[model samples]
Target: MVDFQEFCKHLPFGLLIVNYKGEIIYKSQICENLLNNSDPNIKHIQDILPDSSIIKVIKEGKFDISPYKLKEEMYLIQIALEPGKLGGILFIPEGVIQDIINASPRVLELKHELESIMNLSGELVTISDSNGIILRVNNACEQIVGVKEHDLIGKSVYEMEKSGVITSSSTKYVLEKKQKVTMKQTTKSGRRLMVDGYPIFNNDGSLNKVINISKDVTEISILKKRLEETKNLLDYYQKELYVFQKSEQEIVYQSKAMEKLYDLACRIADVDATIFLHGETGVGKEVLARTIHNLSNRKDAPFIKVNCGAIPESIMESELFGYSKGTFTGGHKEGKKGLALAAHKGTLFLDEIGELPLNLQAKLLQLLQEKQFTPLGSTSPVQVDVRFITATNRNLEEMVREGSFREDLYYRLYVIPIAVPSLAERKEDIPFLINYFAEKYSHKYNHYKTFHPEVIQLFVDHKWKGNVRELQNTVERLILTVPSSQIEMHHLPDKLINTKTKVRGNMNLKQAMEQFEKQILIQTLETSATMREASKKLGVDASTITRKVKKYGINIAKLQFLL
Candidate 1:
């Protein structure tokens, strides 16, 4: 792709055409590069360089020369606007003054065009000697500085410093660096001036003449300060948008219900509050809770997961609240920190918090309220800063009403409640889930079999009452039994693909097919107790049902006895 912006990058030495009224309507080849070292075509010169000398030359019809240096090279670039002609001149320093005379025809032509013109005027034109003495200045210099340039021509440029510009080591530094410096210099006239100190050097790189170009900046400086404040505000908003983008992409979803949940999760991840996850077994509740933790402010801190369902009710208390070395039988000899302590300075995800016995719920509630907990048999209380996120399939609200769960604990965990929808509601996502499970099991058992479209649809259409766990088990079974390169619809359990529609509202398309499939498989198996006879009854190859039975997670032991 051709980028015109690339061309704008080469415009340090530039020219322009302007009307008598001082508005610049056109700039030459190097104008864009001079402004930003980037795209040159962006309109509006004031926006590009708010304090522009382009306007000054056009208004006053001035012949202006500003000395500048870049990368060890000196330049005496001159700008001139002639009367009656709208065109301008850009006399660029060609390496050294002598180099311009011997350069290409294009350079020679431009030099001739600029030198032929005369009678240029501007606000101020200053010429200084090699020793930093003011050598000459035009009549406008008197009006601007409130002093006749002729009276100060022989004096050192440093002597006119009574108007708010106090020279520092910065002046010496610019000379030593041999670079252009922009600074404020007060003239003897008590006028505040915004100035640029330009250094001019000869072909031998010796100091020649240094010129100072200045403009009154009392108003412009105030606007610049305001602009800085707005930029700071934009930077903060940009950071917030970045966080939102990262969180949105991290939420992986294959189902609509989950998709909505993910969007909601991203919105509130940064908020300061406890969150609770509720879902059935094997639905990745803990994983979701951890995701919230990783997205929150405390991401760099620890993320501790304690599965209350997995621990014995008796020791659950001791495990959560640290125990003294000899507090109980079988306690750690050196005393162990509890799960709460281990989770300090980060998130503590209490999985299956509902299973925490009612007697212990009070203690958990107390810790949440005070943000502190005492280790079992340790009289001293331990204070810690921790964010608690709990997950449970059991309905804490229902248990509270039944008096089996603590009401106080229930409210504490339900601050930001999120319900992970059941798999049945996301049946539209069954196809994706099937593929994921199939791939996982195939890799686990070192067996590979691709599924036919019809076979996969059978899995998708089936009512997954057992949700993801049951679905995973079914995939593992199919991987073990199916021998063909592809699994077919008949390979699915007859109860799913062959079932009668008579199965009440409990039956989706999958359950109906499954019932019909099972009847055909059993009848065929009993007819000859042979795959050949079974495949014939089901109108498929004997190898197909062998795969179907495994994939459907059917108990073949019962079928064999009946056969």
Candidate 2:
């Protein structure tokens, strides 16, 4: 008396007939958007969502569904038990309507694209009606919210928050305005998301729906919050490393330009001269300044940083110089010690020096010339021993020529100019820097970190718009969420990875030598299982083999003799 086709007709979405185990025995209609180019298979629900949890519900004959945001593709799938048939419909979201447009099986771009999306990790996606009703939700959202996706749909936006107040008022505003909105939100799943709520407009210019794309930024937020703490920790570790590890001064530097920069920074570190650091953002000005300080006579003293760009012009002077009691509004009853005094025996780093107002510039020039500065409301000239390290991405030389900056102060600060080369200018340092940070943050974050050879080339090939900061961020990003034990070239960010997708295969003279070495080492190792044997076979000295092995981290002991 139970009709199988009649049972499927009761479901709202596309129905697929399945066996007793809920495998896709037969699909009544192919989910064109999801399986349009390929045949449907009986696999785990993660085939549609990278982090979906759908198998548990259908196997138990209970209702299960989850939203999946696979990169550029979005899907809302639902599955409920049927008595006669094993499976039910898989309701995909409306945007997947594009998957229905393929006329032939000549291409599989959509298939691969959806597959890629179904594999990416650490992402959240959702779709809602004009009323902000939950029409769809992804597994990431479920994991984040600690609830199943089916339970989420048909639940009004009102009953969900339960705080009785509509959270993310921006989402409401976006739906009303029918415009895209990007902002930060904390999900019910206890994670921070950089959410982008994009409103889908109907042809009539009315609000049809909104798609909320989100990225989990919990790790990034933690890293950003502990940025200053991480600095202290890194400084402590680096200093400790110097004590326990022997200093390889020559190894500390490999690039000639870097060596020249270090030489210039070291020469001016001991003296209390105003050293101007000129480099693109992320070229490691602060690190260089600290290194200079560490190598200087004032290694024992603190190196204070004044982020001029972050401070307002009105209070910039007050912050740079000390303030006496009752000198200005909100002044400490006990006079505050300015940075100049705070760094009495060490270095003071002024970042974004070009932004310092002209008035304050004059005062700074006076202090630099007079070798002392009186605190606000006090006449006594408080002189102290402090080294000045100023850095800027702007061309101070141009600013002076344009009359925006004081020439006298410019000349004073330019006394010991040290230009930090951008990562592109001296790309040989990219690999070294990547390895150092990978090792450093691997221990710091407790994450497994290793680099592939192609990954190194990708780093070297990047435009590095943010400079070393950009590269460091890219490295940190890889270490945090790259779901692999080893970092391959493909695991790098799309921007960096794409740059090398069509790289020229030509290697210059040095590259040829390296490849020759690689071939010799590979053949030697394959023929013999000992470095001694491989070296003896190749007619090279064993010490040379050892040096090359150390340089490349190759296991010489496993190598064999070659012809």
Candidate 3:
């Protein structure tokens, strides 16, 4: 006389039981809600679950479980066995299984976002279940793995590796070690691949899935071979002829934006037309100008650079065109040749050209047109053969429209315009730039160091207002200040570690004010030791600060320790 209905009443999942005669005996409260029926004895269990395997289990006197669909709803049917007899059948709804297996909404959203990112990524991406069954593959996999995504989706990585579909599998290693693994993989077509596998886990610490990212290093291998072949020959000649000249620091980058800029610069390097470079301050404008000069035919000749704003207005003309022996007091008595003359047969780079005075613009225009300029206190013009390269952080066209810059000069220098991208625009280059700066500074300071991966990730996500220069300076500072070999997050400057979120595009006044307030609160908390101190620093009461902190879910303990 067992009360089967009361037996599974408190379980989170629904449960139903039927006697071996196929008549419904008991149903849990959850099942009543799920099946939308309260009466279990009104009909035979066969009518409710017509295709259930419970009937077969009962007839064969064996326990069984199978999926049963009723009116577009799925349920699990489990048949129980009593001592020497068939017992009853139990039913559990599909929704209960989903709650046990599927992730939360936010987690699912993040997973979807990760998948989207992988889909758009340049590297080959493959994701597989814990058992090495491929679940998804990015478009890049089709080319690198030499198989269509659809063909690989449901296949096992072990079987694929055994069949030589892929030369190797990082997923297998990750599963074996239960951790991230990185190794070199070779393709059937003999392409060298750099593969990294990351293992994901469920909340209960069980294996979830494995994500594999691979890059084809075929071109890199070829370049390494070529370098090996040429290094000795170049070194011998450089030493024998005493022709070794220090090469300027090359632009460190691996981004598509930089690639486009490099290609554009190369295309126009041989041409002698005036080139104008435009970008934000510290975006490597001068480096690009130097790159152009070095790539040109006049690389061996003197390359003179002038900052128009740095020269006094009274001596600007004298500095550019040279002053005669007595043209001005305190001038070089030898009547030194100005940058224009000094750069003859080479290149002259004019930085901050937008800051040039109005009177000097006319002279600059004449020099461009006549290819000659009259020195101060001289009657005759001095002929010159110099290519002109101008750079400006300011908007020259806007200045021309506003009448501060000459329209003719603007047009003359705008022959070939190149725009250098900001650090934020080319975030992919952050890691390379960080590594370069870290190596340079580490060598200079006689200290070997490396950055924590999380620190590097923060640098990549930061909005570098000062562009490449700011990133380089930050890296140098970290190398010098960090006491340990590994630069951790705590070693970074407070400003960098607690940087406010950059507001992009446009926003309404209320939204702007909210962001500003949030930034202020964060800054105050970061610098202050306690809630009262933060409140006083921010010109607010302690209660107000506490209220706002709770609203924003700010981590007060971490903020207090940041200082």
Candidate 4:
């Protein structure tokens, strides 16, 4: 009635149990600890100790106590048989069995060492039986799964998946395939785990156990995604930069003032000082900023432009200096990076710098002086390496005197000043500009057109109050309308025609009256939608409007669209 296997496990001497077929079924703790056997279960008794008579004694149902030598150590083997003919092999050393019991403390230490090995491992280790019942887990497993080791030890992996403790298990694959398997797993606590399941085989090549080594991969996955996104964004920026560079190669210039300005720009391009470009609104300040950036060593880096007056005052700070996560209502859950941070190791062009609000001017000054700025609602400042190029039509010095703009900020941004000439100052370049615009717009509108010599002279003589922008618009308008292959003097806007090209001309009264009549007819046609409208505006009938348009050779199709 007694359970002999349990009784033998408590004994000091080693004991092993084998079936009648010579297969090891059990091995006691003391036997494994003292013998230091990597595998406690040996299939045959002869394999444990060669030339053993223990199996013969079990077959004949006789008690045999004999001397046995194993690994050069003397031991006594006692063989017995159970009612069912199962074999029991007991090993006793040359000394008394009580001496082995006295060394029981050593066995306890060995057990503790095994536990320490598992507990100290950084990776999560989980052991399960061949039937997929969880038997044990290391300390790291508790932290990863958010469950106690004791709670998980007796449970089945299937039950855990059903109960939502873990999303899935890699042990199932090891059990089914009887080989090593690796898979991604997610726990109920939202930890991403990479689990490697290795199947431990018995001597008979059957599945004995499965050990899963898991590593938390949540942070690694997030970092990889961010890296991919950054790579893609960088590719996009590179393409845009290619386009910008190609267009910059097309800038045309012929005037002395423009030639001098370009030479100065090229000389200062490599310097790291702050550059301030001053010009009228229509003059090409932004173009000069691009020239400076392209000429510098940082040309390969980003060229970010922000219009201070265009961005609203409310979010300008956040737009300039990034904000932390959840810093404001409707903000991105993940923190946002600003243009300043995006422009690190590159150039940041702050156009219309004079229009920046007074309060934000101090922060701009901080970035200029300290090379850092704290984002809105953030305590820490982010440092940036940036070459600043600012452009504005406003007179910052006059504003500084009037207390409208900060004096300290003015000096900070005004380190190196370059003045761009207005369209009026470079009047000699008018003919060249006219031809350039004519070619540009003609190609854009899918046609060919040329300006008459008189028309070009008129443009050169006219006061371009709106500067280059006005001239560009005028040229595009003439190309788009003006139905003929040639844009003539009559195609000129009334404002340009009315302004005399020559101060003193050789025209007499007859020629002057005819020129005045032509100007009146062209101006009225431009302001009206139809001949009838022009006739009403000019205080004439439709027939007279029609006759004047033909007589003056005005492009009526151009007049209709202009209205």
Worst 10 residues of 3 by lDDT: 239-248
lDDT value, residue 475 of candidate 3 = 84
* lDDT per residue (tens digit) for residues 523-550 in model 1: 3454445666667746887678888777
Instruction: Kindly indicate the candidate among 2 and 3 with the higher lDDT.
Output: 3
CA lDDT scores, all candidates in order: 0.66, 0.69, 0.79, 0.80
Q: Distance (Å) between predicted and true CA of 138, model 1?
A: 30
Candidate 4 regions exceeding 4 Å error are 1-250, 501-563
Where model 3 places Cα greater than 4 Å from the true spot, the runs are 1-248, 500-563
In TM-score terms, candidate 2 sits at 0.47
TM-scores for the candidates: 0.46, 0.47, 0.46, 0.46
Output the better candidate (1/3) by lDDT: 3
Pick the winner on lDDT between candidates 3 and 4.
Answer: 4
Candidate 2 on 314-333: residue-level lDDT in tens? 88887889888889777788
